[model samples]
Target: MNKQETHHHKGIEIFGKKTELYFAVLCGLFLVIGFLIATFTALPFWFSLSCYLISYFFGGYFISIEAFQKIIKGGFDIDFLMIAAAAGAAYIGSWAEGALLLFLFSLGHALEHYAMNRAKKSIKALGELSPKIALLKKDGKLTEIPITNLKINDIIAVKPNTKIAADGVIIKGSSSLNQAPITGESMPVDKTYIEDIDNLPAFNDIDKKHIVYTGTINGDSSLDVLVLKLSKDSTVSRLIKMVSEIETQKSPTQRITKKFEKYYVPIVIVSVFLLCFTYLIIDENFEQSIYRAITVLVAASPCALAISTPSAVLSGIARAAQKGVLIKGGKALESLGEITTIAFDKTGTLTEGKPKLTNVIPLHNFDEKELVQLILEIESLSNHPLAKAIVKDIKSQYKILVTNKASNVNAIQGKGIEATYQQEKVFIGNIKLMESAEILVDEVTISKMKALLEKGHTVMLIGLKNKIIGLISVMDLPRKMAADTLKRLKEIGIKRMIMLTGDHQNVGDAIAKQIGLTEAKGNLLPEDKVNAIKVLLKRDGKIAMVGDGVNDAPAMALSTVSIAMGAAGSDVALEAADVALMSDKIENLPFVIGLSRASKTIIKQNIFISLAVVFLLVPATIFGLTNIGLAVAFHEGSTIVVVLNALRLLRFKTK
Candidate 1:
């Protein structure tokens, strides 16, 4: 569809969803007029009857259609029970009471649906959130063009306080951004122009300090952002698709409630049928017996219980999406709340995923500057993370020309890279690579490397032919927010937080200590990580694995709940994850877990409220303690309370 047509269709769809609320209001208005006329006005009896008839027509229209649809499909639901009860009331000459029952029932539906709309506000608003037009900056001039016309590498000029036009990196200016519309980040994140794009992560869309997302507002600086994604693939578009599927994926509680409704509705209908005739034996007054039977049906119907879990789950999913968390489904969210242990992949989950060169020691008459120059020429051809770090370190310290003289460079998995530079073989790797090549390192340099290794630095050997020339050490530090996030997780009752890494044992332990993880296991390959997860599974009630790369995908798949950093994780990690933190910030992890727990609590409370009302009213209704009108009032009132309670998730916040 064209953009205008798509908007027209959305408008109609939204308007159609509100029809139930409109009809319910009309039903209530007519019901009130009928009651006032019958109780106080000295009007003709038919006048009140007419108002009651109109109320019945307005209230019963939607219910009758739904009830008949179920019956036609050889099934039954709460709608069928409610329609039957209303008909039974009218059959016994209580037209006003029948109209009251349908009125309140429809009103409850309207209000429950309204609660659902409040939950869906995030998705509906997302469709219109991103700007349709962008100020395209091309060849030193700005032209306003439709976003659909934008392409990759296109630069869009964003003025101060304007919504970002596309997902891109700042190339020319610095600014702070209000990412609340996308990331739920309350503070403005600073963005600086990126000068070295090649240093970015190889296999993922890992967000950089200069990365800008669609729909976020730019602060008080004009920025030229180089577009990275098309309009259809923006963050806002992904959220729309994610949140739209919320209702289709049922939670465990919602699924169970549906099963209960299926059998419960049929049983109530049968019991009400038997009770009407059974009462004939005690009291020949058929009027009183039938009245009691209809009341029992209305009271026993699972109105509030039918909607209890779904409403809560929907609200929970919508609110989570608003806060930059995309829970795959209600089942995932419900299970994540119960996780007793969490496994963090050390590289990206706890650490910043970037290693920095900390020490450079030249040995055996090797010049340090020439060593750096040779290292840069050799490392520049490789995409290994360590190689990138080395190149980044060299460029940051000294300017150099890209001679591209290094040739035939190849990475040796688990060790490092080997190449031909200046017509001589240069080997840049760990001790394993040098030892296998029969290269000799002096005792003094070996002791220095050991000292660096003991201090959690990754030691690499620089060898020229059979002699070790020098060694450089690098370290990947834990994220700035990792310690604080772990503290919050502990306060919220996470019993165990372990780190699984592919680094050396000492390196993992040192990083784990900084992040406060309960345990640190290192020297793990992908399969070894899976085995560790298997071990964790046997000991914990439930476990969650947090990862952000292809290596972590296997372990993540084995966990009870898999969480991936959506913006930073490899595609495999995203596919395997049950939940995704789109913001790529570890700080948001606790919020999602806390939200899941709160949702579960709300679902339980709603189920209890719904059941308690039914249990209390059913006996009272049968014994003559309450009439049809009173039973209907309390029954529908609980449904409204249940829905309103679920809506509380929309405003859920951490202390």
Candidate 2:
């Protein structure tokens, strides 16, 4: 069974496991017994009515009291409307009709309340997925404690196959980390024992020996991590803050709807009073027109209209959350559905941010294995991402030994690293470093490097004695879900998807083509992306920009909607984004788009149905066709119908 049905069943179970059903049967039995006593035993009409009244009170006392309370609060809403209509029917001497209206309205309300509560419960489910406790280490011993109790500089141990309790650095041990829950990037990053000091200079490098963030999962090894931040200090905490902020932004349509309802209800009531008095003045048999006044009031209540839009929006949010997509609120969901085009940042959005060795070019007649060994020996001392990849590549290929006394090893900011290996100058960096060393790259070798760079590969040159010996080309790959998701977007009527990157045009085009992107631009800075989006907006197209690079922030802010890839810990990009992906799975983009569209469709249907009820009911009542029992039925029916329509969002699925 679905969540609503399940929740309804539990509520029914709590009230004697079948209390409503049993009570309904008991009321039916009492009606039959009272009818027999009145007809066959010659009982008084008042005594028979008393028996039926007892049945109604036992079954519907709560609804009657609630309706009365709502009336005193000056909010004569659906409950009060139902009670008034039913009492009016009784005043006209139709007791059975009034009692039946009360029973049906109560049952309809019970079902509607269950549906709405279930949907709200589903939306709040994501906040519960994170673990509450973390194992903190004090005085070399592990202590289990609540995540909220974590403080800065507190060291904690996290094991493989468990969620990281807070945001901090990895102090000890080597393992891969799943960062999808925070950054929306879908990949595992290899982390090592020694902290990369240059990458985290703001915090004391001494304390950042091992750190792990909240919401990431520990990979195949256990490690000790010092909690740098807890709860509100963590990335998830910031995401919650952003989401709450987005929810606070009022939607223009929702505002107008509220204002319309505020004046609409009172005016409708006043008009009904005028209609009743005018009818009484025109005819001497004006008591017959009382039904007309009750009918007009029943038709005019805006309960269905008021509940129509928000109920669907809230239900859609709940549905999106069920699929692991946390859309902040109605405004975000509405904006996301309206996007016409999408712009994507290459690194960490379209392509994997991590660079890997794709090709190795050997110079002269040197042995490839010997050149690789020399490169690994020189690179093993550095902890740059490129350096680590080179070391990993060397370790995977062959076992090699390097002198422990290698000296004068210093890293050049944004250039490369240099070291003296075997008392000879060893240089490894990009093509710029090769020129600075006065190393003349031959035409043939230069042509090969350019070809790789054209294909979006970053080239690292290995030089000795100011002569180029070999080059290692590292290229970023497309994510696993990129192509399939783009195809789905195309299927769903998204006209175009573009990849914007700072890499060479060839590289951007290569990955874009691989991921089904028809439009691709390369070597564009953050400003270029912003201008591109602005130009697109000038043509009246709504755009969604997705990125995980710090440079992509301005463009993200400029787009119609910003989606940030956070799995790689792109905090700056995420902070600038309108929507944060808790999972790196690109497939959710299409899933969420489908969800928004589905919700809009449901909301539109609800509006039409609600308005149709008012139009149909009011006309029928004017012609004296709608009775008190039928009026209450239609009133409660529209409320329940709109509610059910809104709750359909909870069952929404991507596939």
Candidate 3:
């Protein structure tokens, strides 16, 4: 279809959704006119009858359509029961009563559709965030191209105050990017471009991986971003697909209630037929018997029960997404609320995952400045985490440049590294390297190394041949929010919080103490972490494992709930985890758990309200206490209340 024709079709679809409400309102208007003519005006009987007939036509429009469609498929629902009851009432000349019944039922349906569509908008809006057209830069010329036409390594110009069209790194220019849509981060992250073309500043790995995600806003300064991912493979696109699938996953209560409804609908129809037969034997008045039966059938149709759980489940999932938490399904969300033990991985989950140069002590005639220069020169050739820390730290501290850097360096598998500096042999590693190389270390220096280890520092020795020259300490600091987040988890009802890591036991103990964890166990391999979870599972009620790498994936899979730090998470870990904290903020953990608990409470309340209405109306209709109009009003009212209760989750906020 052409653009104008497509718009016309879209307009029709939008109006069709609102037509049910309009027809119901018109039905109520005619019902009032018919009632006034009979009770307050001296009008002809046919005039009132004509008004009621039009009211029924308008009220039954959607209901009749739905009932026939279901019948053609050899199935039935509340719509079928409603249409039969209303037609029977009108057949008995109770035109006003039947018209009122359809009006309320149709209005109930219109309201339900409105509420659900509003809830779905939370996730649907994610697809609209990226710009359809990107300003592509090719051969020094700017061209406007569709985002789908963009290719990997293609450069795009993102202007100030506009959303990025693709995921990329900055090759030229710089800006602060607001990544809230993708990461849920509160502050704007500053990004800079490094144009050494590709080979400069190899030691600073952070800049090499500096990236901007699609749908994030650029600040005042414009940026020239080198595209790293195609539009369809962008992070925002993946999130949209994940959330859309999450909406289809059923909760435990939803499964049970839905299964009950499947068999319940047919049983209700048969039971209504049996009740009418029994009533005819008791009373010779056929009109009253059938009237009572129709009222009871309308009352027990289970409209509210059919919708209570799914509505809450969908709304709960959408609410979590709003806060940047992608819960895979209602099952994971509910399981997180029941957790008693939470095991955290040290790297990237609890700590910063980046080591820092903490201390440097010189010995045997070497000054601190000369020792730092040697360390920087030798580590610049390596890409290890500790080496990067040393290089970064040295560059920030001194401006010394050696005319001849280290040469012929080779790493010893489980020990240290060996190289030639200024025509003399040099070494860097743990004390084992010293023992293997026959280097001498006095008792006083050995005691100092033990003290640094006790303080959670990884101690390394630097020396020339058989003489120790210095002791350097490297440590990975805990995140600033870790202490507060752990304290809050304790205040909330979690019984045990543990730390599991591949670092030494002393390092784990030190970090655990600073973060207020109940216990810390270190030196765990991938399979060992899985075994730890297996042990925790046999003792604890429910447990969660939080991590950000593939090493943590095995243990996460073995836990009651697996949570991944999405911002830095490996693809395997993100897929294996049941929940993704997209912002990598552990503070949101308590909020999501609280949301699940609240969702559970709402689900129970809805079930009770729906079942209570049925129990009340079925018994009352069996006697002479109610009519079709009153029963319809009570039944439809319960459905409206149940839906509105579920919609409350959309506005739920973290405390």
1-655: candidate 2 lDDT, tens digit per residue: 0012123331333365445545545555565665566668876788778866765654455445554554576644445555565556556655554555555455434433332232233224334435799899999899999988889878788887799888777777666665544433232445655445345544434342244557677765788876777676575565444344433344466566446645655566666676676564666356657667766666655446646766787788778777666665454566778876888877777766776667777887767987877777778787555667767766776666654645677665435778888889888887777788888777977888888777667777888887888888777788888898899999987888888776667887778767889789876644466678788777756788888755565566667677876575365565556566767767788878888888888778888987888888887876778775686678668868988999988998877
Candidate 2 error regions (>4 Å): 1-250, 255-259, 282-291, 396-406, 501-507, 521-531, 548-580, 646-648
All candidates: TM-score: 0.61, 0.61, 0.62
Which is the better candidate, 2 or 3, if ranked by lDDT? 3
Summarize candidate 1's per-residue lDDT along 1-655 as a digit string, tens digits.
Answer: 0001011111123348677767777888998999899999999999988998899888887777766766888988777776787777677666766776677677655544443332244345556768989999988899999998999889899998899989888888876676645543222456778777666552135554678888888876789988888988877676555444532244445556457668878988887887778655785477777788888877886667756766787789889999888876555778888987999887767877667888877888899888888888999997554677778888887776558888999766446679999999999888888987888777887899888887678788999968998988888777899999999999999989998876678888888877789998887755577789989989885789998865565577667788998787755566657788999988998899999999999988998999999999988977779988888789879988998999999998986
Which prediction has more favorable lDDT, 1 or 2?
A: 1
lDDT of 3 by residue, 1-655 (tens): 0001011111123347576668878888999999899889998999999988999888887778766765787876666666776676676566776776677666655544433331144245556767898999989899999999999889999888899999878877666666545543322455777555555332224352357778878876678987878888887676555444543344454556346645766777887777676654685476667677777776886667656665676688789899999877555666887887899988778888777788889998788888988887788876454566778877876766644578877666346578888788888988888888889888878999999899788888997857999988878888899999888888777789998887778988988988899999887755577789888988995799998765565577667788988897756567667789998888888887778777888888988999999999989988768877788788878978988999999998756
Model 1 ranges off by over 4 Å: 1-259, 282-284, 354-358, 363-370, 381-385, 397-427, 432-439, 450-458, 464-469, 474-477, 500-510, 521-535, 549-558, 570-576
Q: How many residue pairs clash per model?
A: 0, 20, 0
Q: Which 10 successive residues of model 1 have the least lDDT summed? A: 1-10
Where does candidate 3 stray beyond 4 Å?
1-267, 284-291, 383-385, 397-404, 454-456, 525-527
What is the full ranking by lDDT, best candidate first? Answer: 1, 3, 2
Worst 10 residues of 2 by lDDT: 1-10
